[model samples]
Target: MAEPTMRALLRRRDLGLRLVSEEDALPADALDRPLRWVHSSDLADPTPFLSEDLALLTTGTQFDGLDGADGYTGYVQRLSGRGVLGLGFGTEVHRSGIPDELVSACAASGMPLFEVPYRTPFIAVARAHSEAIAAEAYARRSWALDTQRALALAALRPRGLDATLAELGRRLGVWAGMFDATGALQSSHPQEAIAPEVLALLGDRVIDVLTRGLEAGQSLAIGAHPFMLFTVGRGGQLRGVIALAIDALDPEARTVVTSVIAMAGLALEQSEQLARSRRRLHTQLLSSLQTDDPALARRVLGSIPPAPVVVAVAADAPVGPLSDWWERLRAEGGAASFVAESPEGVVMCVSADDEGLLDQAAERFGIRIGISEPESYSAFSRAHSQALAALRQESSGAYRYADTVGASILSALATDEARLVAESRLAPLRDHDTSTGADLERSLRTWLEHDARAEPAAAALGVHRHTLRSRIAQAGALLAMDLSTFPARAEAWTLLQTARD
Candidate 1:
């Protein structure tokens, strides 16, 4: 509720207050100055005892001995300097009317001066203002209650979060906006109400608050506009922030904003829950596709990314922001894509034509992504494997399967299946060495490393050339490979590298 203004007091008929000072002499907004209370003091110097924003009601007693304009001018100046809103003189009490010297002094000083008829006591004028203040307070409380009800109803709309925010902005007569966890604007009421520079400043403040990972509110001003920002979720798990373009809020208006914040938090929490459920469903669908059954996935999910899609795997990515991004994409009727959480990390499959989407996600989330070559849905599992391999080679940004093809053959063979095969192929020699203490596997590996040269291979093994040759022949017998041939030597060298990797 607004404090009672002097103009409101003059409008009260029962008070019988009349402005005696020339209206032209007063400041244009003099009558509209808010009055804290009305005070009556006849002391020659009432400035020491009076507070600001109040009317000093006098009965002319202070002017009884005043004989010069200097005294009157000093008195009016003191009152004005003390921040008194105006002066009210009780007429027909100590004098027949207001002293001419006092009226001239008030007009010269640009102080509002009024006459209170003796019939209407100073107490009556004070009571009128008190009642006005009370009535305004009551009206504001009623408005607050009604606005809260309207906001609650708005929360029941189809798009409850957006509706609630719009209603809040309308009710408070200010712009309202919501920023996502990523510090990006998610929704705003009266869109485009904020200038670009101010919006950028707001975004910076929002990010600062979010980075603190706390549940708190901030009050700040950008240029001429003031804003109040509040985090919309629990501490350490903030979902987003709500910003109101308001300088200050009365208690009632603050209560209304609190209600809207609660509603928005609940809506966002519900959205997070729904996103999690949808992600789980997507994970299941992706699992079906991984089993080489795109039809089953299609039957459950209605559709999947078209054939000849690139599978991408991302590591150390924040799930909330990415999930929110995906939800926005679906809302905008963008291309269908499959995304899911995996033991490796987050996996996504998009049409090869939409490969830029992966780059966008990578840039937005600061995550490293590895993408596979284009392949049909029937080869989903293979593409997935290729994506995993690409991910192993990725240091940052998006690494594609095609890029890995030119990498070292040793790196290419560094897979779980390759390691298993390599280990199995050399296991017989390992078993023979373990049983008889014959270092056959070591001899064969050393011989392959030295290009099958008997002297250097034996010297490196710290054994005689004849003994090294015998160990290699024994290893060859156990592995069923001819040790002297280039094919056998190359295969042995490849297996050693694969096993080491």
Candidate 2:
């Protein structure tokens, strides 16, 4: 015969029975078996004999008389508070019937109490509860199988990565995210807060789970956020992990998590296979930059990335929105690849597949971008190392982008040179401009700062109209640089940025 659900177990032949017990029943489900036996006796609290193994069965036995059952309420109350499941009472044992006090407490505390007539055997009741639970298990298992099959089918479809992720999320009823081993978000639930750190951590968790051979459906919470982590493999080889997160999920959601991980692993495996050539190209490109062997490097880099490239290193903390910043970059017609340096830094490899896009990104990224020349892909090593040096050499938090040839030259402390030369050349003027009386220097700085706007700069400096104007010209002469020309102004700005400690 099929088992029954808990709801069915609670609705047996008892009615209006006192259930002043089971106040502490733990909210747990039996994975293997439903509860079976219950015993009811007139004993003063037959609780002492049975320990952890058996649940207590009770009835209004010896409690009617003060001689043996005095203050029986406390005994039942304590047993119920200790998490005893159901309390039983025989109606004929005492004409008074089950205690109303016990039943009321049980309901308030979420515990169930059962009443029994002399004809209903406690053993029979236990059998009914066990049978009910078995039925629920069968039903859940059947549902899981159906959901799994549906998810596996969708995952095998030929949707793009974005489409696939969206589909996977819908099927799973939670947010789905995929990130590379390095933690860069390859795809995430659209418009989500999948940051670089979160992406990397998800990858790490997947590897850890698979390496440990954790059971597939096991889940745990991270911080306040809940996640289902899976060790995924594709085409018979493991690729990366996928994280499914949300508050408590329904059974359908849980099933999708399991199926999607399996399918996504296969998808990723196939993708890597299909992308072997592109990956090789990327590797070759990066390799060309890493080495000093020009003959070998140039051969590998070839004529790819016909446009120039630039490298940028995070000198301090990253500022503003990375997506917005990176999107503006893509709009510039450049290809952007990101890698984690550590918690402390990030690096961006920027190249103009189309120079216009690169220009647009530069304008919108709003960070001091560095520029580099059209070195073969093999030149990445040299570029990255040089970029790091440039990062350190420049102001700690300023942005540095390699400029075509200018980047390699400026980045190389040796052949590049000039940080010192630029600093030295501009120092006398720096000092002279500094001592121009606080009022004068302030006025000059404001004027230069506001593009020499007489009124606006004057308003900012809080100086009289004429005082602000005179200081601007005198300050420019002292600095030995015209305050007007684009080049002079740019050089001055660079000097200021470069000289800043």
Please state the error at residue 88 of candidate 1 in Å. Answer: 2.1
List the candidate 2 regions with Cα displacement exceeding 4 Å.
Answer: 1-8, 12-43, 48-56, 62-64, 67-70, 93-96, 100-112, 160-173, 184-225, 231-240, 246-259, 282-501
* Cα lDDT for residue 417, candidate 2: 42
Off by over 4 Å in 1: 1-3, 22-28, 64-74, 99-110, 196-201, 411-501
Task: Return the TM-score for candidate 1, rounded to 2 decimals.
Answer: 0.79
lDDT of 1 by residue, 1-501 (tens): 566899888878878899998787789989887788888999999888999889889998878776789999999999999999999999999889988999989998899999999899988888888888888889889999999999989988999889989999999999999998988898898899999889988998898899898686688999999999989888788989999999889888989988888888888889889989988988877788898779987888787778789999999988768877866786788766888999999989888888888989988778989899999988999999989988887379888889989888787777888889999998887878788998787788888888899999999999999998888888888889997889988888888888842
Query: Mind sharing the TM-score for model 2?
Result: 0.49
lDDT of each: 0.87, 0.54
* Residue 67 displacement in candidate 1 (angstroms): 5.9
Pick by TM-score: which candidate is best?
1
